[model samples]
Target: MKDHVMRLAVGSSARGWRVAIACPRDVYPQDSDSSRYLLEAGVKLIPLSLPGRISPHGDLMAWAGLIRILGRLRPRLVHTHGFKASMVGRMAAATFGVSSGYRPVTICTVHNSIAGQFGSGSRAWNLAKLVEKVLARSTDGVIAVSRALEREYLELSHPSAMLVTCIPNGIALERFISVPPGGGGGVRLPSDVEPPGDAGPPGDVEPPGNAKPPGDLGSPGVLKPGRGPVVGTVARLIPQKGVDVLLRAFPLVREAFPGAELVVAGDGPMRSQLQALAGHLGIGARVAFTGHRNDIPALLRTFDVFVLASLSEGMPVSVIEAMASRVPVVATCTGGIPEVVEDGVSGLLVAPSDPGQLARALIWILSHRDEASRLAQNAFEKVTSRFSIDRMVEDTCLFYQEVFRRKAKQAACES
Candidate 1:
């Protein structure tokens, strides 16, 4: 939610823009990029890990905790993200307004529709939507990640467009920028690997950026932890992400390229089903599930090809991270993917829910080594030139500045 928006805006701002994020403790545990960026930027983080996701842990004392917290953290601006956090956080901000912190502006980001719950006809789905309708009216503003999502959110009542802005998520460049080509490091960059350090310093290049420092250089990056043409996919193993579709396609990929291995990261309810599908396809032995990793850059370094076979998305940061790492991506052409990858230029795209086409694209990239390498190099260059973290931060920073400036001017005119 807002964390995704803030992540894109982190370096965009001058680094001092204070934020009190309301997330579950698990959402930003030590290794996630969200945690890394928050730590790097030195922003004050407020995690809401009440016992039941965002619900209270004991004695139904959530109300007391909210009052105590909002009173203490009188932040300049409070932004609510996701389901639990947004619900609790919005109410907290409203309470602060009536009793204290009237100066703080409260905003919420609707990453998904409250109506879009996990299952059909589920009571939680209806409850979540009801809660969201209340929050939208109370929050100062709303940030929507995609037009598709915006329409869903506005189906009910919300403030005017002036109060709700469409701000898509962006990948942070610093988190993905390659190291220059070597000011003096001796480790050689991997032939197919791209990471934050692989690009090397722009000057006298003695080593590759992806190469570990002198001490760590003895170990290779690309071939590390295992061998074979490694494929990395970062998405929750759920229906929407199309991991099942990827599993069905993997058998065909193995038929074409027997030396390949797959690394599936992240977890969800459908994970077991997808894993079973792998066994049914007879490729289960070749697949490894890392279960929600924080070492994505290192994982990217090991992968030769990156794939995002999702049924839908709104500009995924993981795909951008793959591009930044100079990995050739084979993502499905759906939702906001076309907005990210240019076919035959940055990476290849295929239709969603189509296993054969997805397999064909993967096989094509795997067989044409030279073509894959060229595309990977071009993708890296594109990230460095256009999608750099610095640029995202700059763009997002300008967006926030403009919004806040307009906010101030409107207040003045009204007064």
Candidate 2:
């Protein structure tokens, strides 16, 4: 998407900046708009693919690759994503020593602190905590999408106390508003003479072999030949995400709206457990677990009402995408959700981990179509106005500038 944005949009051109994106693997193990963005913007992409993703084995592999990259590209700044990347990336910059006078500022955005957030009072969780404590000191910048997460990082004693900025993830505003719910996204004649190539996108991936096919997946909200209102949640099926809470709540929603179906997107360690839980809950027949796919937009379109029941989060990308798809959302108030949803206005906000409350909200959205539409419209307006990719990129770029300025000042004092 980054490539497409730069090639087609203003201010994102290759001439505007010299940039580089470093990831363990090529940013696109499979081609994506992100890879395209790097190519078109002419940013040098240095893939630092590591060997294992397991434990010490993965750790050593990642560290070696990252150090090698630092020795080569050695850009003025580095922004790392995910815990593994940040640890290795930040350590490499720090190894260069303070004598460099901050020539290369390191930044990390915590996508999901799974090991920290998950695991119930266990030694494994504690080790993750310890790792975070050590890694926090090496990086120059730490960005958290939620105030909750920023607080978590601060409590962990991150070195840059004041550098912790809360920047929520954003969606492309015009895209959300223009693409109506369920692809009722009214057909507007594009200037293109031929239909956009299929190789292009809206297609990111195919479902894993173990998963069901798209149309066959029996999503209730999908307006297909045989479909009903499917209250869906797209997220990792981890304990912290509270997928179980949603599962428990489904029985109630099903009782109220018997025809209602439940669709779950994304896959994780808890996939089998969730399927088993659905069976246990007696709504197994109504449940569809379409593992992760690039066709999020289509899935979002299928949701007559969307639900996010995470116990903790950082303003999820799913909610924003749903609002863009014009699907009314019923989410729990945990992370940065309150920032996006305006209670009874934009969407309904219920307490986290309460299945009853979540079920009630879902039922309300279903029973009242007019209200849902109005709420969807409100959500659409809110997301389009406040949460946008342009805003996100601009804020991020400004941070880079600040880091650059700080580097220059530190250099002059040293000289």
Candidate 3:
């Protein structure tokens, strides 16, 4: 979510829009990398405490804070991201209008499916749907990051009156596409934010002692000469990401290629549990659990095949990054993944939570170098043509204009 915001905010700012972001100050501390980056990019930071979960007190406080901020800023548009922010932001926009006769063009971006995250028919899902239906009446427009999410919004009872569009998430292609096959110079981070040493947490396993450091790899997917095939993924260690499913499938990958290695990058609450699961599967020594990495471009160069075992996703930027890096992909056919990866063309797809199917896909990619390269190249071309950051930003700004024009016409008709 932070990445999506950073890309959009920076891109929008570059186009000469005076943009400001209202975010939870506690979550992104004053000294955090994101705060520094946004400030450096000339984007204003409005510290608003929006709770992640339901809290009557917190929600009330957030709504009040938004009202105060919106009243002061008096911006022409109030664009919010995710469920919680949308609920509070739209209500504030509506309430602020009643109090001050000023209403901003309110827009919300749905990055993931609420029902998909909290299973359909569940209490949380039902409440979320109800909230979205109510909020749809006030929202001027909505942007779904994938077609799947667009369909979900259209099904809402009140969205018929709202402008809902699918705008796939995009990345800065230049960051990933410029790298050489083996990995050109890694993406540089702010000096204060760069990870120390090899960029893994303490006690994290390093590559084989004889291998070259990650910075000096000779070929894509091979850390050093004589090392085994490397299968890697970058996902938060959470249930929704299905990292456990990847752990179960790794043993099968080792069966076909004994020297195969698995590297799970990124951190979350389930990190310890996943590391233990790898130990239980007896592939502990072969797996590297690097907790939270900022150096994705460099890390991706060490992967023979990139896999996403997510139970759900909304056009995952990680997969696009891998494709942009020219790495072959194997991802689950769930949510917006199928839309991103054409089966057997750009990359292979497997049913979610199916270790056997996932293992087969990984083995096939590793065994068939020619086919994998073709798929990787196809993916690279597709992403370059459709999902560039410039394209997304331009499309978004156009939508903003269309919404404003429609609102103006409606107001004039009433008068």
Candidate 4:
């Protein structure tokens, strides 16, 4: 969610929009690095005491806060991302519509499918669908990050699906593209495309794999010569990411690539458990838990293969970054992954939560260097051509204009 907002905010600012961000105060503290970054980027932050869960009092407080902010800003449009923000932002826009008889355009970007996060049969998931159906009337337009996510939403029979515009997530291409073949190592993009000096490294990744530490995996420069392959993934240590499956699969991968190293990036609640599982499998030494790091481009360059063993995703930005870095990808076939990775073409895809298949894919990528290189080249070309920050921003700007045009047409018809 932060990535989308950061990219859009930066891109939108470049396009001459006076963009101000209103976010839950608790979620994004005023003095936090992220908040400071946005402020420095000229995207003003309006922190509100928004509630995390469904509470009548909390909801009332949040809605009132939004109303106050909107009333003061008198912005022409209110853009929201994710489920909660969309709900609150849409409600506030509706309230303004009722009182002033002029609703500011409300645009929403749904990051994931309702069913993907919560199971299809879950009550919360079904209730969310119902709510989306009800609130979508207030939304001027909806943006789905991928076609698969759009289809998943439409399957719920929500009319909002008709209103959705598909736009795949894009990264600041020059960030990854500028890095040297081996790592960042002082390499730089053209002056025009370079990001601010303080923007820092993006989050780097992948799921867990097993092996006991021969001595201390944390120790630097401890690896033997010809450590074989280094497979990396940049993902939160969470169930949805399927790190556990990666851990289970590592043992089999070791059988083929004996000195293979698994680099798991990102940190989450499941870190301790995942670590224990790795130690239990005697592959802890082989697995490196990088926690959360900013040197993702550098990490990608070090990887022999990049893997994303996710159970669900809505066009993962990490995958795109890996592709942009020209690393061969071995990702699980789930959500919008198939849309991005063409099996045996751009990259290899395996079934979600299948350890055996994942191991095989990783092994193939490591063993067949030529095939992997071809696949990586194809992926790099595909992402560079189709998924650049400029392209995403242009599409977004066009969508916003389309929504305004549609609204104007409706007003004329009513009159």
Candidate 5:
């Protein structure tokens, strides 16, 4: 979410718009290094004491605070992202006390559908869906990250569906494109491998430039002098990611290609359990767990193939990022994944939670070098053409302007 906000801020500012960011204090501290990055990037940071989890009293206070801020700013537009921010921020804007101006063009970007985050059977999911339905009617405009998500919102029978537009998430493509494969850019120092304990918490790493790969496509095993083909996945060790299924599928992949190595990046609560499972499968020695590392671009370059064994996703940025790095991908055909990864066209897609099919896909990519290269090239072209940050910013600003234009006309009519 922060990535999305930051990209918009930077892109808007580049186009000569004054952009400011308002975020929960707990999540984004005022003195943090990340806040400093925002400040340096020409974004004014506003911090609020917003609660992390659901708290009726805390949310009420936050809503009051937002109303006060909106009243003072009295801006022509206000946009909120995510479920909590959309719920509170839109209501606050609707009720903000302003005597002499037209109502602001308040908009919300729904990043995920209620059913995607929580299962359909949960009471909380049903309640959230209801709230979203009501809120949708009050907002001036809506942005769903994918067409599938837009369909989900329309199914709720919200009148605001007419105001909704689908804009797939975008990333900084140039950096990924410029990244050097493997060890060509420079020799990575030992210290760079493991940071000092004093370093701040992990975040996205900048792309390493012009790195070279280990071996040529014609080389045997498609490996470097002493290394095997690395199959990697960057995801949180959570059930939603289906990391367990990936782990289960690893051994099967190993059976076909003994020299293959599995690397899991990112960390979460299931870390320990996953480690135990790997050890039980007796493939722990071949599998590497990189707790959390920011240098994803460099890591992706090192991989022969990337896998996303997620049970569900909303157009996963990780898969897009991997494709941007020109790494062949094997992702599950769930949610908006199929929208991004076209099976046998740009990349391979397998059934969700099916380890056998996933293993087969991985094995096929590793074995068929020419086909993998073709898929990677196609995937790169697709991402560069469709999911660049510049395109997203242009689309978003157009939406804001269209909404504001309609709003100004409505006010003129009343007068």
Candidate 6:
């Protein structure tokens, strides 16, 4: 989500959109990457308190804050991301307009299916559906990051008055593609692209201390080396990501190939629990839990096979990043994953939460080096052709214009 925001803000600002992001102040402190990136990209940062979970008091305060912010900024559009932000932002926009007689068009981007994240009949899921249903009357437009999410939203109780479109997430291909061979090193940005302000060139940025460049993994298509093949994944250690499932699958992977190592990057509430599970499974030494990395492109270069065992995803950026880096992918066939990875052509897709299947996929990728490389190449071509930041930005800007024009037409007709 942070990555999407950063890319979108920068891309929009570069295109002269006068972008401003409203997020929790404490969550993105002055020293945080999100803050630094937005500032560098010349996007205004509005520090608004928004609780991640439901809290009557906190939500009330957040809603009031959003109302104040909306009144002050008087933006032409109030684009919200995430569930909590969308609910609060849309209501605030509507309320602010009623009181001040100046309402901004509201657009909510749905990144994931609520039912997939929270079980279909779960309280959170039901609450999300209810909120979306209620807000549909006021929301001018909706953006789904994946086709699956688009279908989910269409099936949900949204009004026909709203316009919903799918705009798959895209990345700044230069950042991932220019990662120096062998791994851990600064990326070289294209000469045409300049670094923002005094932030310095992105190409000069060095990899983290832990991500050492690895030697060649033997022959072109073989996985045998002095050190075992590295199977890696970058995702928050949360239940939704199904990292535990990956841990359970690792033992089976090790059974087939003893030296196979797993590197789980990114941190969340489940980090300690997942670490313990790795120990209990007796693969403690084999798995390295590097929490929250900034050098993902460099880290990706070290992976022999990239895996995403997510139980659900809305077209994971990590999978795209891995593909862009020309690494073989093994991800679950859930959410919009099948949309990104064509099974057997670009990458391998297995059933989610099935450790046995996950392990088998990982082992197969490890053993069949030639096929994996071919898949990796195919994935690279797909990402290069389809998922570029430029395309996403263009599509988003067009959508914004279309929604704004439609709103204007509706208001004029009513008047």
The best candidate by TM-score is 6
Tens digit of per-residue lDDT, candidate 1, span 1-415: 3446556435533555655555457767767677777777765555554554544443135545665777887666666566565677677777767786364666666665444444435787666667777766666677666666666667655556346666655565565555332112221222225322121111222221111112222222232222346677988777778888888888777665565677898888888888888888888777887677655766676666789988777656688788887777889876566667778777888888888888777766655555666777877776667655555456545556665776788789999
State the lDDT at 310 in candidate 1.
82
Candidates 1 and 3 compared: the better one by TM-score is: 3
Candidate 1, run of 10 with poorest lDDT: 196-205
> How do all the candidates rank in terms of lDDT, highest first?
6, 3, 4, 5, 2, 1
Off by over 4 Å in 6: 31-33, 185-220
Model 4: per-residue lDDT, tens digit, 164-229?
Answer: 779989898898988887683222222213221221111211222321112311211222233456
Counting only residues 3 or more apart in sequence or on different chains, how many pairs clash (N, Cα, C under 3 Å) in candidate 5? 7
- What TM-scores do the predictions have? 0.73, 0.80, 0.88, 0.86, 0.86, 0.90
Total backbone collisions, model 6: 0
Query: Which of the two, 1 or 4, has more lDDT?
Result: 4
Model 5 accuracy (lDDT, Cα): 0.77
Which is the winner by lDDT between candidate 3 and candidate 5? 3
lDDT of 6 by residue, 5-56 (tens): 7788899999999988888877558988878888898998888888888899
Scored by Cα lDDT, where does model 6 land?
A: 0.83
Candidate 4 — worst ten consecutive residues by lDDT sum?
196-205
Error of 1 at 34 (Å): 8.1
Q: Candidate 3 clashing pairs?
A: none
User: What residue pairs clash in candidate 2, if any at all?
Assistant: 1-33, 1-34, 2-37, 3-36, 3-37, 24-49, 220-228, 220-230, 221-230
- The number of the candidate with the highest lDDT is 6
Model 2 TM-score is: 0.80
Model 2 agreement with the true structure over 101-164: per-residue lDDT tens digits: 4436777877664443655468866766777778666666777766777777776665653366
